[model samples]
Target: MSTPELHWFKSSYSSSNEPGDCVEVAVASAAVHIRDSKTPHSARLAVAPSAWVNFLAVVGERR
Candidate 1:
């Protein structure tokens, strides 16, 4: 399947001066897109909404 067009967004923790460490995300029709902000043109990972929520929950617990 072809990748869907996405409008990516970065977390508030992202910094313009340290773009390399930033993680960008986008919501598409069937999945969520995740890619490095420093290399947006590179390959991205897609995750289902349920998986994304679980991942975020884990991340939140670590924070």
Candidate 2:
């Protein structure tokens, strides 16, 4: 499938000087897009809105 059109945003914790380890995310329709910042053209994983919220909550608890 073709990649969806999206406006990507990097994590606030990402550093301007170091882009290698950063990830980019975008929201399209009811799905969320996730991809490596260094490879924008590469395949991205899409997650449902609810799943994305749960993932974030779990991640926040781990911090």
Candidate 3:
């Protein structure tokens, strides 16, 4: 199956004027897409929405 077109955006936490190490994400109905902002065309990761939520929760807890 062909990949759907995704509108990716950088995390709001990334406030640097110059591009640094950051990740981009695109939300889809079935999954969340994640990729290195510096390398958009490189390999990406796709995770279920629930998994994404859990991952974010874990990260937030560490903050």
Give residue 48's error in model 2 in angstroms.
Answer: 0.2
In Å, residue 21's CA in model 2 sits off its true spot by 1.4
Predicted model with the maximum lDDT: 3
Candidate 1 collision pairs: none
Candidate 3 backbone collisions, by pair: none
The TM-scores, one per candidate, come to 0.79, 0.78, 0.83
Residue-by-residue lDDT tens digits, candidate 3, 1-63: 997899999975464685867889999999999998988999999999999999899888877
Task: Kindly list the per-residue Cα lDDT of model 1 for residues 1-63, writing each as its tens digit.
Answer: 876568989965466678578999998778988988879999989899899889888877877
Candidate 1, backbone clash total: 0
Which lDDT tens digits does candidate 2 get at residues 1-63? 886679999965466788687888898887988988888899999899889889888877877
Q: Listing every candidate in turn, what is its Cα RMSD in Å to the true structure after a full C-alpha superposition?
A: 2.6, 2.9, 2.0
**Which residue runs of candidate 3 sit more than 4 Å off their true CA positions?**
1-3, 13-18
Q: Supply every candidate's count of residue pairs whose N, Cα or C atoms clash at under 3 angstroms.
A: 0, 0, 0
Q: How close to the true structure is residue 16 of candidate 1, measured as C-alpha lDDT? A: 66
Q: Is candidate 2 or candidate 3 better by TM-score?
A: 3
Please tell me which model should have the higher lDDT, number 2 or number 3.
Answer: 3
lDDT of each: 0.84, 0.85, 0.87
